[model samples]
Target: MINAQAANPFGEQSKLLETVAAWTLGLLWVLPLLYAIWTAFHPAEFATRFSLTAPLSLQNFVNAWHAAPFPRYFLNTFLLVTMILAAQIVLSTMAAYAFARYQFRGSNLMFMLVLMQLMVMPDILIVENYNTMNLLSLRDTILAIGLPYFASAFGIFLLRQTFKTVPRELDEAATVEGASALQTLWKVYVPLAKPIYLAFGLVSVSTHWNNFLWPLIVTNSVESRPLTVGLQVFSSTDQGVDWSIITAATLMTSAPLLLAFLLFQRQFVQSFMRAGIR
Candidate 1:
C-alpha cells in the first residue's frame, strides 16, 4: 500500500491539500466559538486578553440575563418552535400519506405543485406572506411567525419518500383488518417512518430556532419576538457593546439547541443516515 501510494504522488498531494483545507475551515468555524466561551467565562477586562491565570466567573451571564427580558424571549421561542413543528408534522403526514397511497384526479398535478414549492425559496415570498399575515390580523403574534411555515414542502417530500418505501401488503393487511385510512397511517406508516419523523423534527426545530429574517419582520413586540430577534435587538447600537456580556447572551441564546443536539446527536445522525439509505 505504501509503495502504491508513493507511486500515485498526485493523488497523495491532492488528499494532503484537502486535509489542510478541511482543518483550516474547521478552525475558522470554531475560533469564534472558542472566543465566545473564553469571553463568557472570564472578566470583561480579559475579553481581549488571553491569560491562563485569569479568574473564571459567571457574572457575565448574570449581567446578560438581567440586562434583557430573556425569560420572555425563551418562552416565545419555545412556543414558536413547538407550535410550528407540531403543525408541520400533522399536515405533512396527511399530505404525504395521500400522495404515497391514494390516487386522485389531480394527485400527480398536486404532487408536482408541491415539488415546485420545494424549488421556490421562502424568502422570495416574504412580501406576500407579510401581507397575508396582516390581512389575517396575525401580525406580531407567535402564530404569525409560525403560520407561514406550517406547510413545509421539505417535510412532506421527506415523509412521502419514506412512506413510499413501505410494502403494499402491509397496507392492505391493515385495511383488511377493518382499519380506516387514518388508523392505517397511525399504526403502520407512522411507526415505519419514525426515523424520518425524527430527522425532519430536528431539521424543523433547528431551522425555526435560528430563523431571523421572517421573525424580525413579522414580530414587533417582546411578547412575540423569538430568541434570534431578541438577541439582535439586544445587541444593536442602542445597547452598549460589551463583548463579555454579549457573548454570554449569545451562548445563552444557543444553549438549548446546542445542548439538545449534544444529547441526541447520535440519534439525529442515525435517523438521517437511515432516511438517506432507504
Candidate 2:
C-alpha cells in the first residue's frame, strides 16, 4: 500500500512537470506576438516603451495601409499561394499514386532522392535555381517563385503514407468493377486521403505565404515582389528605418496567416496531428 501511494505521487509529479513545461513553452511563443500587438498599436512616441496608459489607435494600421500597396501585395501573395498549391496537388498526387501503387525498377531509390529534398530545400539550391530560372527567362515572374515548389516531396510522402493506410480491398473492388487504374485512384484513393490533402494544403499555404528569401531572390520589381520583399523596401538603407511603420508593416504581412490560423485553429491542429500520424 505504501509503494502504491509513492508511485501515484511520482506520476502526479511527472504530470505537473509536463503541465508546467507546456505553459512555459506556450508563453515563450506567445510573448513576441503579444509584444508585436502592443507595438503595432502604439504611437511613434510610445513605440519603444511599454505603457499601460497609452491610448490605442488604428493610426498605425491606417498609416501602413496608405504607405504601401498592401492590397496588391495581398492579392499577389494569395494568387501565388493558390497557384503553387493547385500545381502541387496535381503533381504530388500523381507522383504519390505512382510511388504508392506501382512497382518499377529502382522506384524506391528514385523516391529516396525525391524525399532528400525535404532535408535540403530549394532555398539551399538558390544559385542553381536562379541560373535555371535565368535560362528559362522567368526572372521577376510569379511562376519563377511557384515553379520550384510544384513537386513537393513532403506532400508526396504524406499522401503516399495516407494512401497506403487505405484498404487494398477498395482497389480490388474497383478493379473488379472494371475501373481503370486512373479511375480507381481518382474515385477510391483520393477521397480516403482527404485529411492528408487538407493537412498538406494548410502547411503549404502557411509556408509559401511567409516565404521571403526565395521570393526576394527571384523578384526585383514591385510587379512581382511578395509582401515580405515589399516590406523590406521600406526598412532598407535607402528608405531608413521607421520603427513604428516597420512594425506596422510586419503586422500587415503576418495578418493573413494569423487570421487563417485563428479561423481554422481546430482543423489546423487536428490536421497536423493527422499528418504526423500518417
Candidate 3:
C-alpha cells in the first residue's frame, strides 16, 4: 500500500509536467501571430506598446493596400496555384494509377526514382530551372513560376499509397461491367480516395501559396509577381520600416490561408485520419 501510494504521486507529477510543457509550447507557437494581430490593428505609436486604451484603426490596411499592386499580385498567385494544382492532380493521378496497378518492367525502378525526388530540396534546382525557363523564353511569366512544380513527387507518392490500399475486386468488377481502364479508375478508385485527394489538395495549395523564393527569382514584373514577392518589395522601400503597415499587409496576404484552414479544419483532420496519415 505504501509503494502504491508513492507511485500514484509520481504518476500525477509526470502528468502535471506534461500539461505545463504542452501549454508552454502552444504559447510559443502563437506568440508571433498574436503580436501581428496586435500590431496590424493599432496605430504606429502603439505597435510596440500594449495598452488597454490603445485605439484601433483600419488606416494601416488602407495605406498598405494602396501603396502597392496587391490586387495584381493576388490574381497572379491565384492563377499560379490553380494551374499548378490542376496539372499536379492530372499527372499524379495517372502516374500513381500506373505505378499501383501495372506490372511493367522497370516500373519499380522508376517509382524509386520518384521517391528519391522527395528527399531532394527543390531550392537546389533553382538555377537550372531558371536557365531552362530563359532558354524557353518563358522568363518573368506565371507559367515559368509554376512549370517546375506541375509534377509533384509527394503527390504521386501519396496517391499511390492510397491507390494501393484499394481492393483489386473493385477494379475487376468495373471491368466486368465493360468499363474502360480510365472509366474504372474514375468510377472506382477515385471515389474511394476522396479523402486522400482532399488532403493532398490542401497540402499542394498551401505549399504553393506560401512559396516565395522561386517566384521572386522568376518574376520581375508586377503582372507576374505573387503576393509574397510583392509584400517583400513593399516592406523594403527607402522610407524605412513601418511595422504597422507591414503587419497589416502581412495579415491581409495570409488571411486567405487562415480562413481556409479555419473553415475546413474538421474536414482536414477527418481526411487525414481516414487516409491513415500518421
Candidate 4:
C-alpha cells in the first residue's frame, strides 16, 4: 500500500484535497454555532464585535429564560418527542414483524406503499393533514402535531430489515416452547432488534425535536407549541430581536439534543452500523 501510494502522487493529492474539503465544510457548519455561542455569552453591544477583553456573563441566559414561556415550550417539546417516539416504535414494530415474518396476500403491495412514503415529502401533505386534523377536531394540540408522524415508513422499513435477519431457528424454538406469536416476537424479534430500535428512536426523537413547520401550523398557543415554534415566536419582531437573548434561547432549545448526541454518539454510530449490516 505504501509503495502503491508512493507511486501515485495524484491519488495522494486527491486524498489531501478531500481531507481539506471535509475540514472546510465542517468549519462552515460549525461557524454559525460558534457565533451563536459567542453572542449568547456576551453583551448586545459586543454581539457583532470580537474582543479578547470581552466579559462573559450568564445574564443573557437569564434574560432569555424570562423573555418567553420557555419552560412551557420545553415541557411541550419533551412530551411531543416522547409521544412520537413511543407511537412510532410500537406501530413500526408490529408492522415490521408482520411484513418480515408473514406471507400474506398484498403484503408486497403494502410494503411498497410504505416504501413510497419515503419518497413523498411530509411537507406535501401539510394541507391535507391540517384538514384532517380540523375534521377530527384535534387541531392546535400536541396530539395533532404528532398524529401524522405516528406511522413512520422509515421506522417500519428499518425494523423490517432488522427483523428479517433474525435466525429462524430461534423463532421456531420459541414456538416449540409454547410461545404464542406475540410472545415469540416479544422475546425473540424485539430483543434482537434492540440496536435498530435505538437507532430509529434516536432518529425519530431528533427529527421531531427540531420539527418546526408542522407544529407551527397545527399549534396556535404556547400550551401546544414546541421549542422550534416557540423560538420563532420569541425571535419575531413582536418580541424585539435581541441577538444575545435570541442566541441564548436558541442554545437552550438545542442543548438537549446536542448533549444527547454527544453522550450517545458512540452508541448512535454503532447502532446504525449494525442496522445497515443486518
Whole-model lDDT per candidate? 0.91, 0.86, 0.91, 0.92
Return the TM-score for candidate 1, rounded to 2 decimals.
0.92
Q: Count the backbone clashes (under 3 Å) in each candidate.
A: 0, 0, 0, 0
Q: Candidate 2 residues 1-278, lDDT tens each? A: 57875768788788889999999999999998887788788887787788789999878888888887888888889889999999999989999998988899999999999888889966778999999999999999999998988889999988887777778889899999999999999999988777677778888999999899999999988788778788875677565676777788898898878887788778767766876775
**How well does candidate 3 match the true structure in TM-score terms?**
0.94
TM-score of each: 0.92, 0.93, 0.94, 0.95
Better of 2 and 4 by TM-score: 4
Better of 1 and 2 by TM-score: 2
Choose 2 or 4, whichever is better by lDDT.
4
Q: Per-candidate RMSD vs. true structure? A: 2.3, 1.9, 2.2, 1.7
Q: Candidate 3: deviation at residue 205, Å?
A: 1.0
Candidate 2 runs further than 4 Å off: 1-5, 237-240
Candidate 4: tens digits of C-alpha lDDT, residues 1-278: 47987788799789999999999999999999999999999999999999999999999999888878999999999999999999999999999999999999999999999999999999999999999999999998999999999999999999999889888899889988999999998989998888788778778999999999999899899899999998875567774678998899999999988998898888889988887886
Model 3 regions lying over 4 Å from their true place: 1-11, 276-278
Most TM-score-accurate candidate = 4
- Using TM-score as the measure, name the better of candidate 1 and candidate 3: 3
